[model samples]
Target chain A: MNQIDLGMVDWARAQFALTAMYHWIFVPLTLGLSFLCAFYESLYVRTGKEAWKKIAKFWMTLFGINFAIGVATGIILEFEFGTNWSNYSWMVGDIFGAPLAVEGIVAFFLEATFFAVMFFGWNRVSKGFHLFSTWMVAIGSNLSALWILVANGWMQHPVGMIFNPDTARFEMQNFWEVLFSPVAIAKFTHTTSSSFIVGSLFVITVASWYLLKGRNTEMAKKSILVAAVFGLLSTAYAGLTGDESAYVNASTQPMKLAAYEGLYNGKAKADLVAIGILKGQKAPDDDTDPFLFDIKIPGLLSLLANRDAGSFVPGIKDLVYGNAQEKIVGVKAKMERGRMAVADLAAYKNARKSGDKAGSAMALQKFGVNQDYLGYGYFSQPEESIPPVKLTFYSFHLMVTLGCLFTLFFVVFLYLAYKNSLERHRGLLRLGVVSFFLGLLASQAGWVVAEAGRQPWVIQNYLPVHIGTSNIAAGNVQATFFMFLGLFTLLLLAEVKIMLKQINIGPEEV
Target chain B: MPGYSQNNIFFKWQRTVVRFYLDGFRAMTVGKALWKIILIKLFVMFAILKLFFFSDYLHTNFSTDQQRSDHVLEQITLQSKIQAVEDKK
Candidate 1:
């Protein structure tokens, strides 16, 4: 019942974060560019255009480079589950590990098996088969993303699982619910669409640079036309899914939503912080004012969160303090309930061990009632419940702002490319180049919001991060953390060098 | 491409992967030694080596679920080496 002071927790967290961020750098591009390659290859096959094939081959080479590096990081990412978070590996392994195991066994195998053909089969296989291989690679990669995201979604909003006290882990109760969770569905669409947008931007940026250089003008122009349209459509899709995610977060993690919105008190028809600067002087856990200035859209937050304009939305204070409009339970009460749940589970185990069946049954019944709030049992105080609000608020805003800008950019770029005037507007082309980094930043911020906003909880309302780490020594974890950090950095550098060399080589050379 | 239904896309993809797998295996016969080396290396690393090195700690150290969980809790809740270092500093 007493809290353990595990210093390995921070090192483990840092290592995982390092690997995830590094892995993401390549994964988004791989997810998007695979489709672009397949699309280009499809055109080549249909129209008998050598130019299309050239474009396809060029992007496919880049995709290969990105894919290799993504795989390198991805392997380590999965391994870390066992090495760093062994406790988590067991605690939710039954439910959480299923999708992950499926990702490796099914999706990764599909991608890896077909990848050989996609790359090497060009010389050995027929034209149709090669094209098919390319498409398969794309599908496999996205399918891989789907399974992983499904696992992540379950962590964010744990569903279709029952905690077995005897096993001391959550097990899958309904495979379909786990797979088809609304949170997972929204996350898949949102995340993949953003990756598509990132991919489209990469194409646009590269093509724009080519246009500026007065090289590969035809290829560049055509590529822009394709990428711009795809990007525009993907941007719209990302927006819709993002909206859905917000609703899901409100339902599942209202505190996270409140923090991101900078909502400190309950309000009926809550306004959205449209454009504002959050006052950053206060510690995240401190109860100082959240912002200095703001522009808000009236009732938009309420509408967005609850899908009802007049619905009462609880903010940090209401959620934390138990207001008259206690639409949400305060952290204190939840922790108390969680403590009861924890004690009951412990008692049930103790009673069962001693062959006291009646006592075990009573304990089990009590635990079942409070099991949902069990994660809060680990927290020593109400203040521990609050996530880093300032970071969440800003990251949410920055992601949204950048996303909106990129969507607008894509719209204009697509129109210009459609009319074959994309090159004429040099300024807009330069902007297109800039939007590549903007798109990347937005994606990163989205990730930060998703990860950091759900702080303290590795599995929201189920497990806390500090308790979920492997029982490794902090020194050992720290040492490996540095080792992986160094190795991954070198790999990233190598990736960049190889990519540049390949880019300079150009499609004509290939 | 735009009008391709989701189901069709998935089916087409599945078919392509299966075909590729078959074709790849057939093609591998020509480079039999290379395929053998790759598969062997993979098997050794993932299957053989993993069995020796990555023993499941919870399973090995504890028999009952309660003991396993209690150990994890104790490890996490107890002041760690890093914390001791920090305290010394």
Candidate 2:
């Protein structure tokens, strides 16, 4: 209960978000492009085609550029945990740091070792060994993603940890449970598959540029064919995993799900909003209409949430205020219990300091009873539990809409490429170039929905963000935030300049 | 089962891998630029950022692990005490 500095919290949050978003820009491309390189190399190995080797080598160059900058941004992200969010680190580092450490020790080393082999051993190694190296790099990069996502998923839905009153921390109880949590699995699949779509989009974008310019015609067609097919499959897989993520959110973080749908009133047969425009901000339980205009499918939300059209999906108001019929406990009640838990914890510490064993034990027992609602004690009011509705709603909808558009974009390009008439379609080729930016936008929007929608809480029900930040001067965090922004922007510009130069040099040169 | 010939083969394989990397690094085109970027970025991140901007506050302030844990405990428990007094008011 140290007096929280709102400014420090905001600055720290902004710094973390800025670093994460910048890191993400490079990660998805690395995730997908590595596999595409592997596929292209596999084709070269199988067919003994020089063209395929050139294609693989071209993509691999871009991948290497991206991969280097990704590691640069990623290292800083891990350090921020210790610097900006030391409280969260100290509280759950036992569990959270384990996966990240494994990622560095196991996955990173595997990637780094094979990456040297993949890039340098092209002519030196045998065909089989070279292909093996490429595949290893792909697996290693994705494995690195797996561990990072597992740590993030734990934050969103913390499991397999038990709170220790003695240390004032949550200690790991079951490592396997933490690793294999359903939320982690869904998040990994969804995030990595979406990354694959971004990779494919990048390939198609560069290839389409070539087609539009009437250069590298055969190479462009072949590259488009491979990327479109890969993108199509990844889009489908992403869709499936996206559905699983929504279903998991429905149960574990229903307020987030409610915010995504802009639901303020509970309903038995909730309709899923297909497209909507928000009128303005409305408080929970207010009579004002949340949406200015909209279209929706009846009972789809209930079906998505519970796999039953008739099942009730609670909304923001129902979650904020207790619903007797729905058996939903309000945030107000949770806050009360959380306050009791906090008070008892304080009493327990004081009693132990005074050497009153009986009094300490009594307070500890009361604390254990209400420990589940512990994070709620930090909030002053029930409505503090609600995340920004408009942001979450729009981000989720925009991501979904773009996901569908990418699917169609891939299908059309794939058809044109196979038909051997892709060069004739100037307009679609232009769209293909533009679609890469849209893919990046969709990927970023998905993160906004995931992170921004779960506002207030850093560890779901366990800890609020205000309590999780390190005790630091707001000015220090703000200064570092600008420093990182300037540094990352410079690096991003350098990466783009290098990538564009490589693209202009063309695959024939590669 | 192991013999001089087997040991010789293993040594030869290791030498081949080493030679491969050395030759590749020597015969670089774009890779030289990439290596420079990586080195410069790493220097900035570690030398400048880690040295000046970011520090592990708990580790810097507290000498012992126990002291750090105790500090966090104080922060959490102190909040509850303050809130309890406010509730009474």
Candidate 3:
């Protein structure tokens, strides 16, 4: 166990992160388009306008393509749970399985069933039914998001469940506790809005491009306007939700929050780094550099965490890296102490065999002293002995920068909308396209930071990463990873080709 | 081990061996095929009739809610060389 091969952890970390990234290319669109489709159909309902109707159909076509890819990418992720992280699955399957089953039974079917009607039932169904179909797709997508969030929230904050050593699984003791986790709620709200932002900006970007080319001017203008309004509002919400999510993390997953801020220790008044290197100290086993530069945060960190101008946030040094020596020493010393105690206990038993009660008692007392070593069993180490601080530091900046950009863009766009110049403001229209890419970039960076920061631990304070990977052949993982990787690439290519071709044509004239 | 004449017993043994291979083929090819996928979906929806009312699978395994909501600021750089590097258009 001590000299465990690290190859699996490396492979798994690479595979899961890669798969998630590819899967994500489709996810934001799912969350965003579902809402946009509903909005388009609602406009059609209110105005009885054929132009709005056409816009709804146009986006639906895009949504259908994205959804199919999303669904296909998603199934791979599920199988990966059992394939790559079988130990983690076995340990948490009971708790995790419930939510997964619910999503399949409810969300997938709801969306898929109604999605068909929304896509191909233009002449087959009534207008009201079609509208209902669009709404159901939105509901199904959101609901699917909700259930998955619940499970993930559990991983982050670990509520409503307790570990059973005999079965080596966490059993849910309270259903409601799992359902309404603080981390889950905050994350769900923040995440859904982010998706809305991605979707809105995506549609707006293409629509604006169409406008620039003067293709389908009437429909394109309307599409751009709808995307703008939703994009602005949703982007604003994404920021707000991110703040709420940060607050939740600050309170719950303090280690992650500290990592994000690159705080090495608790300070009197922490200056939030707008830019800086995140090199400090690494464990004895780690060989990372001790210096990085340019991390700069003024007072923004305090404001976000505590809503106070100068509240102290514990830096990673004080809690994680700062106490590294103690954790390692504590674990090692305790393990040795436990073994010594067991040996003493055996001696006591030997003495008793020779009919020496006093000597046996003395040995027993010594043995009792070492029993304290058992406590070391729970001292799980972080997955990465020393994190790639430079990568984490840069990714964090990228996420924060994109977040601030979206904030500014939405603020300005909202003002333009209120000024009734949303359509005419070509500057804002162009900015929306840039924001679309920025949002995607920010999301990717955010993901990188979150997964990398957790480093080493698949189950936070409970499981070491190397212990949690599947005990399968290396060749099996390589083969499947490559197979799926190839298939996913093909799917993504197909999606992009179709999307670009459709965007080139723009919406058909009403 | 059927109780019968020698000819009858021989025929039964042959049938059993044939059925074993048939079942093995069914599990490997048929059960794991796209047809099984369609069946699982159908059973979850059309046969059992609770697919719409159930929302558990999405919650645990494939929900965007968890991915989006739990944005842990950990940066993981993964190098994947599984596919031919194509343009990300």
Number of the top DockQ candidate:
2
RMSD of each: 7.2, 2.6, 13.5
> For residues B1-89, what per-residue lDDT tens digits would candidate 1 score against the true structure?
77677579787988877776677657542234334433543454366434543345567668877787666544432435224423534
- Output the better candidate (1/3) by lDDT: 1
**Tens-place lDDT digits, model 3, residues A1-510:** 222234655666677777889888888889888989899989998999987888897888777667755565565566666666655666678788888889888775898678666765675568899899899999889889888888878877778886542234568898789989888888688778878878877886776666556566667667656776787787678778778877887777666766666665555456777866655555433444333666555777877887886877765544533444333232345445644654564565557658888987887777566643422222333222334555666787788777777666766755665565656777767776676787788778877776676554566545546555554555556655665577568667767776676666656621
Q: By DockQ, is 1 or 2 better?
A: 2
Best of the candidates, TM-score: 2
Worst 10 residues of 2 chain A by lDDT: A1-10
Compute each candidate's TM-score over C-alphas.
0.87, 0.96, 0.73
When only the first chain is scored, the TM-scores of the models are: 0.95, 0.98, 0.83
Can you list each candidate's DockQ?
0.09, 0.43, 0.02
Instruction: List ranges where model 1 is wrong by over 4 Å.
Output: A1-3, A281-289, B1-89
- For residue A81, give model 1's deviation from the true position in Å: 2.1
Those runs of model 2 whose alpha carbons end farther than 4 Å from true positions after fitting are B1-14, B80-89
> Where in model 3 is the C-alpha error above 4 Å?
A1-4, A277-299, A307-310, A321-388, A411-431, B1-89
Please, what are the lDDT tens digits per residue for candidate 2 over residues B3-36? 7563598878888888888998897777788788
Please give the fraction of native interface contacts (Cα pairs under 8 Å between A and B) kept by each candidate: 0.06, 0.49, 0.00
Task: Give per-residue CA lDDT, model 2, range A96-158, as digits (tens).
Answer: 778988898867578978898898888878999999999999999999999989998999999
